[model samples]
Target: MLIVITSEEFVEDEINIIKRLLKEGLTTLHVRKPFFSSEEMKRWLFNFHAEEHQQMMLHQHHFLAEDFQLKGIHLKEEHRKSIKGKEQDFLEKIKSQGWVLSTSFHELQEVENQTLFDYAFLSPVFTSISKHNYEGKKFSVQQNKRPVIALGGIKTENIEKAYQLGYQGVAVLGCVWHQENVITSFKNIKKEYKRVYQ
Candidate 1:
């Protein structure tokens, strides 16, 4: 699987590029704008056709999942800790509704210990393209045993590397948004994902 993340700052014509990718068979999109309010997310997603809603996984304002019938809810560290008091109850609730659950991790050991998620993201497998001077962790994805998605500094050139290293999938941030031609860039990543894993 290949996943795409929204840039923290809006890029020009971002939604239209995303729409084109959906037509080209984009499956999962992680809407991770930490600055956006639920209303802002709703207003922005309103621009898309309703059929596309199932592909979106919101990183904030997860309640919007019910309103939009989105793919699922993604939790950060803070959100995950907040529900720790009633983790079982929360899990049951999401399961009853058939919502997908995902989270992010910076360390590979943490991923091995965690069993609550459908998939987890372990990032900085390479130096971050958008974050200044944040070096890569360089952990071997081949050692990972869970459904882990590699994030950070992933581009078409190195997508096959990620797969060979044993990642079930990859999530793109900088490679997709920072490019001059976003559609072509995403298409190339998708193409490479198929080449390596299919």
Candidate 2:
């Protein structure tokens, strides 16, 4: 199972926790700090000294990715639409730089329409602190072969349910961020996910 850690929810000790998770085998680390400025993010990346084990992805800032040499960039559905006509241009730029691109979708139709990204995130698969009223009743992966990550409200207990429902992996925030022991929480979640997926 792959774990994608968001930077927004885990502000304090973010770098430390991320480093720990990367060492423990996190598949991807998405630096999704929408509130922070590009300069601030660059500063954080420089100061944090993120290791090579965790592939880093910036959110909605393709320019910064180019400047900082990040592995990839993630765009929201709205952002994706705004760049619709320029999809090829954007894809070419990302490809030229050898960067992976991903986007988030709220519906299956959107997922079906999106072909430019390497993966797509379908969120709120289960009720989560980051989101509410997500009972997994409306979430479905459909027939899309592209990797789709089930985000929002995913925990150690419900990860198996997510994978069973056809998600390539699960993205999380509060589940690990809110824990007093981030390392233990990540390790346990990773262990549980491996057991279920294996």
Candidate 3:
């Protein structure tokens, strides 16, 4: 459940770097290019192998996911609420197509409502480049019966703290994308995770 977020800012070579990382050991690759059009995502998916596509989850664009047969779809908190009362219906529809659902949660109440998806991202577990000054934020994992992943500013150094706090795993963005060496960064973080949890 080690999730790595893909960035639109990644250079062409960076895509290859990520592909290599995926081959090496990364578990989940979240295609979170908020700026990418559905056409662009489709093009990117077409370029990758089926194994890569199978491990990838789109950030939004449920229709595109269905069209491509992606593993699942993730929504931001705002997007999650827009379809609020119809969550069960929506989940059933997506589930029927063999797609899982995931969303973000900034509060305890959101985590408590576990009907939407298989997991929720409870973020800013540590100060992160993607989120600044997140230390003051509350990270309540007690309300979740389903798996809850810690996101936001997570890095290799603080992953143990995140797991101790009851997160299933950490979802990373800039820490991996903005690194000087993406593969090494991912391997280091992943190794630490395995060492600690093992």
Candidate 4:
């Protein structure tokens, strides 16, 4: 249950690094480029083998899920609110297609109350590595009802703490992408997560 989230901005050799990460056994990838148009995203995705599609999740252009058969679709916190009235039907459709459903949560209580998503992300368990001045809550999910993955500032050093705090998994952004050697960074995080969980 380790996941890698794409940097919001493009990184050099990103596609190749991602392919390498997948080959290195990355459990999942959350494609969260908010600015990418459907065409751009499609063209980018075209680089992967069809089998790699199952390891990917989309944060936008969910309609592409039908075309690419992605593993899941993520609802941004705002998008979740915008679709309030129609969320059930929307989620049911994705579920019917056998895709995993996930969304972001800023509060631990929000995750506990959630019943629609297969899993939810709880962020800032440590001060964000990618966003300046965004503080960490160090949220504890001991009472959560479903899987809650820790996001924000996750890296090899603190994976055990996240697990001990009751997170089912961790989602990484800056810890991997900000590194000079992305693959080594990712492998270290994954190894730490496995040591703590498996």
The prediction achieving the highest lDDT against the true structure is 4
Regions of model 3 farther than 4 Å from truth: 133-138
TM-score to true structure, per model: 0.96, 0.90, 0.91, 0.97
Shift in Å, residue 197, candidate 4? 0.6
Please write out the lDDT profile of model 2 over residues 1-198, one tens digit for every residue.
365667464367777777778878886888778777777777777754435422788785568777667778889767876997888997898899998888888777777666788988886677775555655553778577788888888888898888778888888777888778878988888888889877
Best-first order by TM-score? 4, 1, 3, 2
Whole-model lDDT, model 2: 0.76
The regions of model 4 sitting more than 4 angstroms off are: none
**Residue range 1-198, candidate 4, lDDT tens digits:** 899999989799999999999999996999998899999999988888878999999999988877998898998888888889997888778878999989998887788899889899998898999999988999999888799999988888899999989999999999999999999999899889889999
Off by over 4 Å in 1: none
> For model 1, which pairs clash?
none
* lDDT of the candidates, in the order given: 0.87, 0.76, 0.78, 0.91
Better of 1 and 2 by lDDT: 1
Over 102-166, each residue of candidate 3 has an lDDT whose tens digit, in order, gives 88877767687766678888866666675556662537575468999888887788888887787
The CA lDDT at 96 in model 2 is: 93
Q: Report the alpha-carbon TM-score of model 1 versus the true structure.
A: 0.96
Q: How many clashes in each structure? A: 0, 1, 1, 0
Residue pairs in collision within model 4: none
